[model samples]
Target: MTRAEGRPLRADAQRNRDKILSAAVRVFAEDGLSAHLERIAKEAGVGSGTLYRNFPTREVLIEAAYRNELAKLCDAAPQLLESMPPKQALRAWMGHFIDYATAKLGMAEALRALVESGVDPYVRSKEMMLDALASLLEAGAQAGTIRADISATDMFAALTGIALASGKPEQREQAERLLDLTLDGLRTSPR
Candidate 1:
């Protein structure tokens, strides 16, 4: 596990870290803060010592899980752009945002507890989300498929509103319909 300055982690160490994060996400999603570290270690197929070596406390693990999910959502922008048209990419990302919001809502209690304990688990979350949305909007603007007047901040706020209003299971269909309406508003007008 040795490295030079800012060198990347070795393959095995990286794999172990990824496993631990994945296990933590599942455990936290299913059992919240009360999820056992030993269970996460077992699920990751790693030893309990390894889990402790990576995440010293429950808060650390929860924070890491939250960050990992955010990173994955952010990272999807490039892949989406590569695989689909700019407008399609934006639409797909909106769908992912819904999933992200859903998961976060599910973890609300634990997250609030972490915040109450003086830990800012949401550090850089807004910036990261804005950046991701910016990428999608930039692509759409360049493609002439979306209006240039709308800022990423505007879209972000709209998405957040949609998430909050449609967060319940019974409201998911309505939320998606609202998303489509929002996307329609962002589209360029025909001559």
Candidate 2:
């Protein structure tokens, strides 16, 4: 439903695209590259034509799905902060990050294959993640609930370490404990 150059997508078209991307993420994560586009269309409640129109190729769909998930995770930062104290917001956001990480692991093999085919599926991932971390940290620091010296990069590394170390269901408890420890370390001393 896009028009000539510089025109915005029609609302229905945008909705269809969003649906397709969301469905693609779940399908790809669950089934990897073996997931069929027709199945994705069914999951999205859209026609195959709509899915094809939005994403012409498998690589394009995979890349778009991964980017869409990243955007959803990163976009949660401000919404969480708005509804809760910054410390709580950061903690909540961490949980969302964990979920994102889990889905990401499922999609990793497919994304790697996409990269092997010369399509980088994560062009803006690092920057987007860093920005999300920075926002959460900044909110917490401004509220005097978190230390100011922590770098977003360092925090992201810590989260990634925790996720990788305890990503398994059997190690979920330990992972939670580690995440709590990391969160505890972010607190500033009461002045």
lDDT of each: 0.87, 0.87
TM-score of each: 0.85, 0.88
Best by TM-score: 2
Candidate 2 lowest-lDDT run of ten: 1-10
Residue 53 deviation, candidate 1, in Å? 1.8
> Which lDDT tens digits does candidate 2 get at residues 1-191?
35447688989888988899888878888788899999999999999999987798999888888888888899999999899999999998888787778778878878999999999878889899999999999999999999999999999999999888887556778877888888999989733
Which pairs of residues collide in model 2? none
Q: State residue 162's C-alpha deviation in candidate 2, in Å.
A: 1.8
